[model samples]
Target: MSYEFERESLENADDRIVAGRAADGDTVAFAVLVRRYTPMMRAYARRILSGSADVDDVLQDAFITAWEQLAQLQDPGQTKSWLMRITSRKAIDRVRVSRSYTDLTEMELPAPERIAPPRQAEANAGVAALNEALLALPDAQRECWVLREFGGYTYEEIAEQLDVSVSTVRGLLARARKDIIVRMEDWR
Candidate 1:
């Protein structure tokens, strides 16, 4: 088949097939997988890393790791979950490394700018407040919450990713929810 034909075919192929091709060393197929999953992976990274500026770096690291380890993927059909798990781990690693460095200086605050409508401003404030609440959460609880709520991982899946028991995942999620609710009460 011609290169264009192969590329088009891969574009329309099922993830399992594309992933298998990627595992077999087809760079185009791998590119297709990257294109298919990058958005979700980025969003997942952003949620886990909170306001960290290294979210893109974390995602790039995950993709590089994925490329290096694709051959070890036990099931091609599970590629999406596998990629997400890798992203979660990379984000966690970044958080761990960042925790060691203390920045004592306060950042210059941005000047307040009015959002278009009052309702829009109120909505933005609520979102900003929620982000602050999420940032305030303990790292474990925040990871569980982001993986479950944003990444759409099951409790069992989160437990596996975090190397914790299912009950522990449940407890973390519950605590996170309660804390976020308390923090956001003023906005309601």
Candidate 2:
């Protein structure tokens, strides 16, 4: 299936239903969860992991980890963010555990240009630079940025997800944005 079709199908489903069923040993429901979240997870992992081919592997491991830990989850409504949290941690570990001196490549994902007008070329370049700068940031910094910008989570939500103080999240976000702006200025 095309990525767009897969993504649309997954997003259209009731996440609560999927989570509840998956929590009850419903493999199909769990598979649905995997299918629904895999693209986002892969995008996230790719950003953190760079050019490693291990993005898929990390996502798979994340799903398995989520499955095993489902029973421990107190709120089914929070499953999506919880899964994303696990995925991010797993991707971070893959980078940390790598022993070889491998030169990393730039991480890339398909853009939405084909489906929309290209009027925002300059803005797109800014976003691309921001994304690259983001990839180079510390994991905590990147996580805070993504959770705030992409996941639409508030500072409190990010702090809760990351088990950090809200002040820490605020500091991370400030550092992240300042670094991104500096790098983007260099690109201009």
Candidate 3:
């Protein structure tokens, strides 16, 4: 198994034991559980945060929420997925909250002084065009594409994360690929 899976498996076992102890009023055991899961949770939060600086705050809130609600979790084996769902929701919420506070004018600054050679500049322009095309896609299609491309998630995993069917994930991927091909053709 990959490191992520191995860590997740270990986390599940640890969570079960720690949660049992925590429920019995062992604060030290609870702390141990939080410590064990913190790294994985922060890594996932960072991935979702991308360039955001508010990830630490988001993760703190998520962990607190998870701790308060752990008693309600029926299956200890799925702790990682549960934590991830919480983290993703919190990270998205942070983005939404921060967007309103950001200055749009600052984003319009002129390009940096250092310039690449003509060929490199052309390649950069191509990448910019591709990103623009991705931005033009519908939210659902774009999300499916990003999860597959950036997260390395399989169709089944994407489907599970998005709460959709595997066939729906496949259709979204097909449509996203077709859209990219058409956009690249026009760009060329």
Candidate 4:
């Protein structure tokens, strides 16, 4: 009934209102946002960092960056995806610093919802083959692939992130996709 009572009861608050409150320096609002997004953000970072122990560091840095720059977010309602974008960039930074990307072979798998147990093994083997394929790629190609596939960034965003031309990103991604398909054909 109050002008901003929902800020106190964040369970039902809209992301736009919550994010706007957070941008206005409300720590409690930010904490709610942090709690809501941490799991998804952690999972994304883990997927991107891929067997690296720097996941925590990436998440911490991402949250800090988000906290500091929340005011700059163009659309407060898109908080979830915005958080993911920040986490993706942070994960990419860690991968760059460590010069490591994916190790799908070492990754553990959860039970498939609709897949049988045998299919789980098949999926993991497929992942291993894909990992090997990715490892064989040049760094630029691998970075472009990971940024596009895992981060869901646009070609222009990736080009800006990698400091390359859009055409270069396109070329690199095309080559990477071709290589992965060629390498994975044996698995299929």
Better of 2 and 4 by TM-score: 4
- Which ranking of candidates, highest TM-score first? 4, 1, 2, 3
Compose the digit string of candidate 4's lDDT tens values, residues 1-188: 55367556875789998899999998888988988899989887888888578988998999999999999999999999888878877888888888896887766556647987788888888888999999999988998998789767799888877888999999999999999999999887
- Candidate order, lDDT descending: 4, 1, 2, 3
Question: For candidate 4, which ten residues in a row score worst on lDDT?
Answer: 2-11
> What is the per-residue lDDT of model 3 for residues 1-188, given as tens digits with 9 covering 90 to 100?
67566445545566677676665665665666677778877766665555356768888998788778888878766776777777766765665565422222222224557757886677566766677777677766866776687556788877877778999999999998899889989667
Number of clashes recorded per candidate: 0, 0, 0, 0
Cα-based TM-score, every candidate: 0.79, 0.64, 0.62, 0.83
Off by over 4 Å in 4: 1-8, 108-123
Q: Is 2 or 3 the stronger prediction by TM-score?
A: 2
List per-prediction Cα lDDT, in the order shown: 0.82, 0.75, 0.68, 0.86
Per-candidate alpha-carbon RMSD to the true structure: 5.1, 7.1, 8.2, 3.2
- In model 3, the clashing pairs are none
Model 3 stretches astray by more than 4 angstroms = 1-13, 23-25, 92-130, 154-157, 184-188
lDDT of 1 by residue, 1-188 (tens): 99999999999999889999999999999999989999988877766665457878998999999999999999998999899889988987787778621111221224357656876767666767877887788888887887787668899988988899999999999999999999999987
Q: Which residue pairs show collisions in model 2?
A: none
Candidate 1 regions with alpha-carbon error over 4 angstroms: 100-116
The digit string of per-residue lDDT tens for model 2 on 17-90 reads 67877889877678888877888888777766665789889988998899999878888888878988897678
For residue 127, model 4's alpha carbon misses the true position, in angstroms, by 2.4
